[model samples]
Target: MPYEEENIQQFSATSSSTSHSFLRSRIGLVIEARETAAAITSIADAEAAGVEQIWMTQSPPTLDTLTLFAAAATRTTHIRMGTSIVPTYPRHPLILAQQALTVSDIAPGRLRLGVGPSHRPTIEGVYGLQHTAPLAHLSEYVAVLRAALWEGRVNYHGNYFNVHATLPRTSRVPILISALREGAFRLAGEISDGAISWLCPVPYLLDKALPALRAGAEASKRSAPPLVAHVLVALSEDENAAQDAARKRIQYYTALPFYARMFADAGLPVAPDGTGLDALARSLVVYGNEATVVQQLTELLAQGLDELLVLLVPVQDASRELAQLARLIGGMQ
Candidate 1:
C-alpha cells in the first residue's frame, strides 16, 4: 500500500475530529532553562501576540519550574501554561503531581504536565542514576500519575515501578507524554492524556505515531486525546543559511544515540556525515521565507498534528526571527 493511501485508510477507520490549537491559532512558545527573565517576557509577549499556550523545559528538573510556572501563570490571564518535557528519572510522579496541581490551582485548570523517560546522558551522566527499563518505567509512572491525579488509589508493582499510595484527585492535570518510538507511543495512548513530539516529521507522525495513539485508544476503548507537535523553526531569507542552521540543530539531535536511531528509522541517512540529519534538514525543520515556512508547516498537518509549538532556534537575532514567524504564522493568536 502506498503511504498516502495508508494515511487515507487510517483517516477513514475512525475519522475522529482531531483537536487542534492550530486553526484556533493554537501556537505556543518553548523556552530553555537559561532564560528566566527572557522566558517570562517571551510568555507575556507571546500571550499578547496572540499565542495560546506557554511551555517551559530545561535540565536539572529543578530549574525552579514552580517559580517559572507561577510567574508565567501570574503574568498571563488567557494563555495556558505547560511543562514542555519533564524527565521522569529525576522527579517522582506523585510529587510532581502535587506541584503541578498547585500551579493549576493558581491558574485554575490550565496546567499541562509533559513527562518522559529522558535520554541516557541526562539520566545517568547528570543524575548519576541509570534507568534499565525506560518504557516500562514510563508506563508505570504515567499510569500511577494518571490514577493519582484523575482516578485515585493506585497500587502498582512492576520491575521499574512499585507504588502504593492514596493520591489526591482535587485537580485534573493533563498528562502529556514526550513520545517517539513504538513502545513510548503505546504507553502514551494507553495511559496518558496526549503526546509531545520533537524532531519527528509529518510523514512519521501521520503514518506512525497517530496510528499508535489511535490503536492505544481503541484497545482501551477510551476517547482520543490531544496531540501537541512542535519542532525547531527559523525564518531566513537565504534558504542555504536556513538549512545550515537547521543542520546545526539536527546535528545536536542526531549526535545523540537515541535520536540518531530515530532519525535512521525515519528513513534518514545515518551519520558519519551520513546521519539522518540530512533528512531532518529537508523534511523536519522548516526554515525560510513566510510563504515557504507556512507551506512546509501546513504540509505537516498531513501528519495529524493537533498543535504546533514553533520553537524558535537560538540565535542572536531571535526576537527578529520570532517577529517574522509571528507574521508568517499570520499573527500568533
Candidate 2:
C-alpha cells in the first residue's frame, strides 16, 4: 500500500479513548534566542502564560544554549527547560554530563537534557569532524552519558568513547533524544527518557514513530516514554501571511538532507531545491487565526502526541507575535 493509505488506516484504527486522552497532555514552547536578555524574557513570559515547558535549540552562531538555560533557570521558578537537542559530535559525553549536572544544580528538577547525533553536513562539513556511524556513535554516547548522569560514574569503553570518570553530582535530569527515523526512534525508546521530533506530520508520526518507539521500549522491557512533537506555529488573521511566514521560517530546514527525507517520507511534495511551500506548511505548520490554530493543535494532540512544543514563527513585530501567541495559548485553556 502507498504511505498515504497506510497513514489513513493507522489513524482510523486509533481508539477514540486514546484520541481524547491526549487532549490533556502537556503543551510547551520552543523559543529562539537572538540574545540572552530576549531569551530570558521569553522564557518568563511563556511560563507566565501557563506553558508547561520551554525548549531551546542548540545551533552554531547562536547564544550558547546551556548558558542561556542557566540564566533562564534563575529568572523562572516553575516552567521546565530543555535543550531541544545538543548535538553529540563536538561535545564529549563526559563534558555533556557535567554541563547537564551544572544546569540541574541551578534549576534542580526542572532540567531535561535532550541530545542527538546531528546531521552529517553540520557535523562533518562544518565542524571538520568525522560523522561515520552516527547511530553507533549515539548509542555509545547515550550509554556513557546516561551512566554518568544516573550512577555518577561511567567506566564504559565503547566504539566511539572510552571514558572512566565520576561526575560531580548525580542528576535525575530526564534525557530525550532527537529521533526522526526508525533507528533513532528505537534508541530513544530503549534508553533515553523520551523522544523529540520536528517537522513530522501527524499521520506519519502515528504510523511510523509511535510504533517504532513502542517496539524499542517493549524490546527492552521498559515502558514507552513521552513523544514530544516540535511544531512550527504562525498566528495571524490573514491565512496567506501566516503560511508565508511559516514557509520562510522552515525553508532552510527543507534544504537539509535529514529534514528533506522526512518530508518526502511523509508524502509531502518537496523538491530538491525546495518548492511546494503550501503543502509543506499545511502538513507541518500550525497556522491561521486564533480559533483555527487552536482547533488544529487540539486535533494534533488527539493523534497521540504526548507533548506539543510550539515554535512560534514570527509573522510581524516580534513583540506583537509573542503577545499573539500568549493570547492563543490563553484561549486553549
Choose the strongest candidate by lDDT: 2
lDDT of 1 by residue, 203-233 (tens): 7777777788777866766655656677677
**Could you tell me the TM-score of candidate 1?**
0.86
Task: Give the per-residue lDDT of model 2 (tens digit) for 1-333.
Answer: 011223223323243544322343256777877888999998888877766577888877677788888888898997788888899998998898888889889998888788998898898888989998887888898889888988899999877889999987788678888988777788777887778998888887888988988788778776677788888788777778888888887788788878888878778857866677679887777777777877888877666776777888878887888767765664455
RMSD of each: 5.4, 5.8
**In TM-score terms, which candidate is top?**
2
Candidate 1 local Cα displacement, residue 71, angstroms:
1.7
**Model 1 spans with C-alpha error above 4 angstroms:** 1-22, 152-154, 166-169, 274-276, 314-316, 326-333
Question: Each model's C-alpha lDDT?
Answer: 0.69, 0.78
Worst 10 residues of 2 by lDDT: 1-10
